[model samples]
Target: MTTAVAAPFRFFSLQVVRTRRLGPSLARVTFAGPDLHAFHSDGRDQSLSLFLPHPGQPEPAVPVELGWESPRSGEAGSGGGWWQAWRELPDDVRAVMRSYTLRALRTGEDGHTTEIDIDFVLHGVEPGSPVQAGPAARWAAGAAPGDRVVMLGPAVADNRAIRFRPPADTDLVVIWGDETAVPAACAAVESLPAGTRARVWLEVPHAEDVQDLHTAAEAEVTWLVKGAAAGPEATLATLRAAELPPTTHPYVWIAGESGRVKRLRRHFVGERGIDRRRVTFVGYWRQGLTEEQLREQG
Candidate 1:
């Protein structure tokens, strides 16, 4: 007899209740919603689509409601509530969509108010980048108790076609990531079995970029400072040179800029001879595209 596999849950939206600076260039936004109750916390590395309103708009219309059972096709929902507000947004304002990770999730006693955290990487003083350091940054930078923004995401986790279930006796793991993927990489490291030998390579712009991370496994971390040549391609070369135990079963995860991730994926699976299943490669962001744009390109 054959058992049927359950269908994966679809994505949904949340309301940003607050936002704050986690570090110099990292902004943490906290979101809440009923849908979060169904979110799979074990899939921490997954990407989420975030919908932000036009700068001056007071209230934004809501898009379609998403859930485990929601049908895949439909016009944006028609209610005059949050959903309507989003539907009526001006074309220019409607165009602003960003992608971020589900950094962490907290389920309360009643499972009603799930707090989801997302970190936005501030890219200098530019205006167009998500979480820029300009005027809009002030909004996110100083967001307080009552401020709110529309959020839609926690898209299904990227389960690579090649799977590697680390053996019970496996000794080591290696994780490499850029700022865009720090949350996911950190979460993966934290979830590993206790006493598992692990090494984490993180590439960030500044010294303050190194936050106090929480992880359960024994981890030796290396931080790559993007000083002179801060491009993603340059950083990957630096990280690849760092050595790991060749004999140990190393489950490697590398994620970040698209170009760099693509190159590393080729090098590891093609040249280095590591089984494709042993490595998870994700392109968290591309050089010149927004999160939504990145999705469209993919």
Candidate 2:
């Protein structure tokens, strides 16, 4: 059933329509649902919460809480209502929740979303990998057509979930993201208008993860291949030594590992002297912690 969790965002039951391997480390999954007629988004770095079922479950276990007077009221009950109830579920029985970005979407003539694409970063899924694959990565790697799932996504075209916003006077757009944030960064880049100037850096574990980005704007995109080292030192060194174009009004967007995001944000605001207000930074995930652990610490 479709449950309205909050205004501009709600739960929609969806099924996997198809899956495509984007690269060695990325997989693209497309989903569709009858209720997607209500799914609306402007699509620049749109954020979403995906709930996946465990291996053999027919669907993600999400109990809809309809006790509120208005689902759009933006208030939770004493125990936080559905969130609390869901949390109270047995660990193995509850749906696996993960935060992701909308990579792309298509609409019909009536302006209803017909399908949406999300790019999943596959980690440790390959044979004999050093790191263990996460739940979402494993689910995505073997995702097949007709796999059932659920999504908490935008119902408003211009919602607060979208973080990329360049002022009208912005002369330059600077962007950086690791593999996890590549989908969001790419969405922001693809949405750039004609004649806009942009510079982007995308870091990935392997060279095969490099993607060909298509944009109308005057954009210079660089793909940084990470070495065996497990930190952002190499990325930071590259940014420090590179030269940027002269622009008084520049907007910067950086996302990826939490620690690295902070470092890059500082480099832009402190080292490059860009206005902090003009820079948008997001930490998609932490290096050593699982998503559930990260949420718990929050």
Candidate 3:
């Protein structure tokens, strides 16, 4: 029922082949489908939109045709895009849409995708948790084999959705991400070439959420646990006190809560004197807002 307006992004009908719990706060779901023949991506921080059916529904209720212009209004291209059509769907009938990062994918001998993985952060899924579980978290917590879903992803290997880009002259790769961004950040770091220098800071809600990253790069990684030394103040303090290796050109990529991302960006550009053009900051979510509210504000 969720529709993306971009033609470059196409819909893929997928089903969960398996699921694995990564930690107390994270789970990995593997999906496969015939529609993956057209799915392609370079994979670094690749962004995707996923659609899920309501409880008891067999499949997501998407429109048969996502035409750019609706002719029913008796006007020429005045109706709006596919997003409008998706919004017009009844609340109970509409699919639950969530944004996720592509963790990894496997290809067949013919170079067609055979399967893909997405890691979900299970926020509020634990018993007696203070925060309430959102639909995506709740769905991911109980996702099982044969669960149907839909994804809006790239048809081209290289697209704008893949944002972890560093210039040719870059000598140091700096990364910071919270639990919500761990999947993308891990994928990006793991793909770095040998001899590359990197400094990574990954913050997770629990100690169990910390993961061992395998990378060819000479990377110094630090994991911060929430109640111990995570969050905006502690994270910033640690970064501020630490010393980075000498490098003429450094590229920085940070994603997480919007407010924290902004403060970290300022620390890199304003305090550390790194070039603003060399930094890429993404706000995956805001502290006090839902995805729908964030989209509406945009």
Best by lDDT: 2
**What are the runs in model 1 whose C-alpha is more than 4 Å off?**
1-13, 65-90, 93-95, 110-113, 126-139, 154-170
Residue pairs in collision within model 2: none
Overall lDDT per candidate, in order of appearance:
0.63, 0.89, 0.88
* Candidate 1 per-residue C-alpha lDDT over 128-151 given as tens digits, one digit per residue, 9 for 90 to 100: 544445333445565555455655
TM-score versus the correct structure, for each prediction: 0.76, 0.94, 0.93
Per-residue alpha-carbon lDDT of candidate 3 for residues 143-207, written as tens digits (9 for 90 to 100): 99999998888888888889999899999999999999999999999989999999999989888
Better of 1 and 2 by TM-score: 2
Best by TM-score: 2
| Candidate 3, superposed: residue stretches over 4 Å from native | 1-7, 67-79, 228-230
Cα misplacement distance, residue 263 of candidate 1 (Å): 1.6
**Candidate 2 residue lDDT tens string, 1-298:** 8986546777788999999998889999999989799899999899998989998899988765543223444543224556777788899989999999999999999989999999999999989988999999999999999999988888888988899999999999999999999999999999999999999999988988888899999999999888578467778888999799999999999999999999999998999999999999999999799998898887
The global Cα lDDT (0 to 1) of model 2 is 0.89
